[model samples]
Target: MAAAIAARLFPGRIYVASAGVRRGSADPFAVAVMEEKGLDIRAHRPHTFEDLEDMNFDLVITLAPEAHHRALELTRYYAVDVEYWPTADPSATAGSREQILASYRNVRDGLEKRIKERLGWTPPVSA
Candidate 1:
């Protein structure tokens, strides 16, 4: 969702990608939720943070608390700004299909809001 919003709002200004601490397939619920807002996450694949080592970024935004700590530790080897976003883990939510999907949607919405505000970009509307 962050990547999609960034792509839509900032175009080429920032390069956005997402990775998990451990590699896992993209969550179906995540795809459904983002689709609700017209963001297609269907092609996203989970990546390891190590895969990002070769890339250069001006900023690293960690949406999960654990990732924040790890990103901080990783940043020592490179010079870049890292910010913790403290977003909830939608996968941890337990409920029926509808409820679980709602959680994911909330996460997508939260990320979109945070990214727009932090990056000084305009909010994205459903497309």
Candidate 2:
């Protein structure tokens, strides 16, 4: 979701990639929440840090404690900047359908907000 939001917000200005500590499948709730914001993550496949094709990145923003630690380890081999955002994994949230979606949406919105703030992104003016 962070990659999707950052890509949409910055487009050609910067490159964005997202990965976790381990490979996993996409979350249906995540796709739904992203769709709510007009961002499609239905095809987004969760990958691990090892799956990255290129390691030449300027910055890597990790959303989980494990991922943050894994990313810190990467600094030993790659010259990259790592920032931890301490995001909660909404997949672990237990509730009804709407409640589950709400959890995912919270994560989506929070990630988008942090990305915009960290990257200095502002919506364009309507003329």
Identify the leading candidate in terms of lDDT. 2
Please give the RMSD of candidate 2 to the true structure: 1.2
Worst 10 residues of 2 by lDDT: 73-82
lDDT for model 1 comes to 0.80
Clashing pairs in 2: none
Q: Summarize candidate 2's per-residue lDDT along 1-127 as a digit string, tens digits.
A: 8899899999899977888887777888888888888988887888988988878898999888888898898776877888989898898999899998999889988998898899999888899
- Model 2's alpha-carbon lDDT is 0.87
> Model 2: residues >4 Å from true position, as ranges?
none
The true-versus-predicted C-alpha distance at residue 15 of model 2, in Å, is: 0.7
Kindly list the per-residue Cα lDDT of model 1 for residues 16-108, writing each as its tens digit: 877647777778998887777787878888776787756477888888877778778877888889888888888999989989988988888
lDDT of each: 0.80, 0.87
What lDDT is reached at residue 8 by model 1? 75
How far out, in Å, is residue 74 in model 2? 1.4
**lDDT of model 2 at residue 29?**
87
- RMSD to true structure for each model, in Å: 3.0, 1.2
